[model samples]
Target: MFPLVMIASLVALGLLVVYYVGGYLFQNRSLSDIPAASPWAALTRFWLVREARFGRRYLTVDDAHKTHGDFVRIQPNHVSIANVNAINAIYGHGNGFLKSDFYDAFVAVSRGLFSTRSRADHTRKRKIVAHTFSAKSVMQFEQYMHQNLNELLRQWDLICQKAPANSKFARFDCLPWFAYLTFDTIGDLAFGSPFGMLKNGQDTIEYMDYPGGPSKYMHAVDALSRRGEAFAVLGCLPFLKKIGHLLPDSFLRNGVRSGSQVAGIAIARVGERLASTATKGTERVDILTRLMEGKDVKGQPLGREELTAEALTQLIAGSDTTSNTLTGIFYWLLKSPGVLAKLQAEVDTVILSPTDEVAFQTVKNLPYLKACMNEGMRIHSTSALGLPRVVPIDGPAIEICGRTFEPGTVLSVPNYTIHRLESIWGADSDQYRPERWESLTDDQKKAFVPFGHGPRSCVGRNVAEMEVTLAMATLVRRYDFELYQERFETWEGFLRKGFCCEVGIRRRMT
Candidate 1:
């Protein structure tokens, strides 16, 4: 009798879930006209969750655009727009498209600029740190950049030194090397100290249980990647977070742990900086120093919690995005030897010698080098996935690219899809040809949004440009690479990241 009752209860629960989900999908009357990516997309959120969990969310959505055209219903309420013209209506300033609830998963100590939804709040936050990312301010960070790059070159030099007696090349993975470079550079710039990742050749870093508490080490890059993928999956269906501990999926489970670890790491860094500031009675010229002194709209200095949150944002944003771009550029360069030669020629003109520090002013305006970087960004988009924005339910009707989107509809322009559109980029849109960027059409310019479109675009754009160009120039001027793998594979989670770019690198003959 007990077993029969249990079976009946289970059946009832299943029926209730089905009924609820069915109603939830069909209840959104405004979304009826938008074409669903698939029947599964229309029926359940499972398909979306699966794609996000397994790290193909961006690709899957891009494929949907190929089949369904510009507007695709990736989720019951979410529409993915692939049209370039829709950019202004959707993401332009004062468009009333607040960041969707999808960003709630990315919240660390508090809502940093990237995760903040409120327009006024985003404005206030941007005001606090925007100057630090400006062109001039970012140039000030080049000293730290050069230091970290030198450390990276030291490690790579040792690897090359170990090459066989006859061979000029030594096998090394460029992706992790780039990761180390970016992480250390950002660490020094943000915290007034480096993570020592480049020197150590490992991702392990120390964190604390709390401020001034016992410290322990964790693999930060792995934690960050796992948390990013996991949070992306869970963010789609936020309810899963509550029962995350009970879930069978280890990735999701580990992501929850990683999130805590990341938070703790941020807290620990902020705490150390505060302690240092108090005891030393002097401040280093770093992002944290500016944050420590920054006043909010109310004229109050940001609290420790806010400072830690911003620090966490900087670590995640400042490192991975630029590193991924660097990796992408290297992958493309190695694949196209002719292009690489051309870029090297341009770089050599400016960089002069292997030991010469690549300055921002020297490399910033090089046309071919700029073209190569632009091409790399276009081909291998870091933030491949669409950043979802909500059409405010209370706002006036907004028309985007000849179609009126109902209020409360979630919308996004998938960067991966728009970038690869044959209409804008011509027939060879899929290729990694730097020459294409040398003569881009007006449509191509509109379609290119690796940083993103409108006011909410990446605030750290200047810093990213300085980091990438300087690093790439230094690399091309110093080494010649032979790729180990035939294909450069990438996966899309929080950002599109390469698995690895294994190469046989040797000192440049020049």
Candidate 2:
């Protein structure tokens, strides 16, 4: 009798879930007539979560767009939108949509620029730190950026110098070097000194130096990214973390640990800066320095939490985005020697050298170099996945294209898909042609958002562009590189994949 009662209760609970999920959740509340990618999406974000866990969300969403047209119901309350106009309504300044709760997963600290959801909080933070990213700041950061670039060139020069004469080529992977260079550069700009990555030719972030031999700090960052991928999925399911042994890069282990470790590094570096002030030396000139002294209009300085959060944001956002794009730029350029030669000609005409540290201002105005960067960014948008923003149901009704979304709806536009949309770009959208940039209309130009758009866009955009342009100009003018490794693949995750370009570089005979 006891067994019968238990079995009956279990059966009743299963039917209740089925009725609630299938009957109620599947019936579109206010997202009238928007076609779901599958019935599963209308019922729950189960399909989306599963795809994200495997790092295949973008590919899956992209396929859905192709099948279901521009808008696909990604969840019962979430819609993945991919059109040029959607960008303005969703991400443009003054839009009422707040960042969705999906962002809570990325807040390393309690608060920061990247993860802060409230528009008021974001704006307040943005105003206080805007000076750190000013044109004057970029000009000052140039010397520090070049110092790291010089080290990178020195390292590459050593490789070229030691290569066998018969081959006249050194097989080297530029990915880790790019990571190290960016880390060192951002370190100098944020911390008055670099983490010694370029100088040491190794991972500098201490937590990354785990038991399985040493690894790149960015690898831990990557693990954190993949960890977000797992959480974004497993979070939808309850008690999945209990089976921690089954999940290698599960939420509790790698992601949280890596994120917490990176945050500690940021906080510790801040502690170091605070301690250095009493020394006989003048004040350290870096973003963090500016941030510390900066006061809001209300005469309040940034609190310790704000300071640490912003500094970590700079290190992570500034380093990864630039390195990935630089890697992408090199990947595209080497694969297309004709484009490389054209860019080389454009940059070489400026009287730069392989051995000389190229200034950001010198290459800032170069047309083809700018074109190459833009083209590379388009091909591999750093923020390729959808930047999700929740619609305000309490405000006016939101209608994207012909579809109307109710309040509390989640809207995301993927630049990865939009970048290659045949309508916005030409028929050759899939190709890596830099010249395509020259003929783009103003509206077409607005559609390019590698760093994102409006107030919420990347604050370090200028610094990133400066670093990439200078590095690209310097590298192209100095060496002619050929892709050495036949097997090159992008590491796919919630953020980006592991796309590294291993190239055989030889000094130009000039």
Candidate 3:
């Protein structure tokens, strides 16, 4: 009886192993059963190792799209679609896809607005803050924006003046300046207190410190995010969570502590704002106030935890993305002198005086400047990496270029690859030509998705654009700048961090 029982147990264990392995292999099945080209074969084990060790060659992904046409499986269970039609199908409203576990890394504080994976949950969270980003709410914050821009311009003027007469040609990267302006603006708007980045010329956020500067934190977060992806992959194992606890406490502690600090700050700020109804007039009308006053579809007020998560999410989303986009714009403009001149001409023509506070209406009329901003966003999208989404159960099987993706298949459309595709944008697609935007028809414009498409598109996109336009206009109109470093290299360690362009600046003679 004992021998028979041992043999049965061994047989059961063997079957279990076979079952799991078969499922694993089947889950990662090739997408080539349909008519799509097998372009991913080129990116074999050797190539992946090289690509992983070195940084992501976004240019290489662009090249792959050219060779493979619209749809190509770039990795095992991962595919890239360059077709414009696919964008709507992949990320459009009611697309029936939820963000994949790849986004789980961003869940720093218990599933905030950005970290929520469920379509229903996202809709609920979005509704709570939808009014805050409406046209009316943004206009209300115009004064706050103007004040921040003025602060930035004042600082730049001082910096330009301080350069020694002999060394007046001193060069410094405009990236840091843009970073300070973006973070400071978001800091004030979100937390009601500036990180004092613009005033101090450094990131003095109590918990987080951008050692090499604000840009360095971008790099660190990118690296850490990649590590988090590895953890998620490992999490598939049954006992991995238990093993995770055995890993270094510091790794888990830092993330938890940082999240707690951010949440604490946001909670405290909201409490303070709510406490002082005396000063809660138009001046206190930031995103926080809007959120505090908001109620869900069922007329339930957002709870304290929900408010904290949402607020911190806004702070992160508003600050980093805007900073990255603005940095990219400055980087490109400084390199292309003619583009800079054209932008300056538009600003000068529209604003009449560069130093004067730019009203929303005046800034809106500068089509060329707007086009330039759009082009920069397209060329070097801050959200360059593919935002992964999982296929929903009971949804129509997604067919991309004759290839069928089953439910639960992880899918994405890499923006970096899509934006630079020759088939979509013509030969000079990779070049920074804002004029290309002018040539685009309405249909083509609809395909141009820097902030993504549909309801899930960036909530703060309008605010971000306004901030970038005002900052670029103010800087170009006030200064004549040259690239300190000629070559532009992007370090895509994780979230396209260390992506900067160094430049030299001198105040233009009035």
Between candidates 1 and 3, the one scoring higher on TM-score is 1
Off by over 4 Å in 1: 1-26
Q: What is the Å distance of residue 438 in model 3 from its true position? A: 1.6
As for candidate 1, its clashing pairs are none
Candidate 2 pairs with clashing backbones: 393-407, 491-497, 491-498, 492-497
Q: What is the lDDT, from 0 to 100, of the residue 68 in candidate 2?
A: 81
Measured on C-alpha atoms, candidate 1 has an lDDT of 0.85
- Per-residue lDDT tens digits of candidate 3, residues 184-256? 7877787676767778777545432211112112232223334433333322222333344453545443433
Residue 435 in candidate 2, Cα distance off native in Å = 0.5
Worst 10 residues of 2 by lDDT: 207-216
Which ranges in model 3 have alpha carbons more than 4 Å from their true place? 1-21, 28-60, 207-283
- TM-score quality measure for candidate 3: 0.82
Q: Rate the local accuracy (lDDT) of all candidates.
A: 0.85, 0.76, 0.66
Winner of 1 and 2 under lDDT: 1
Best candidate, TM-score: 1
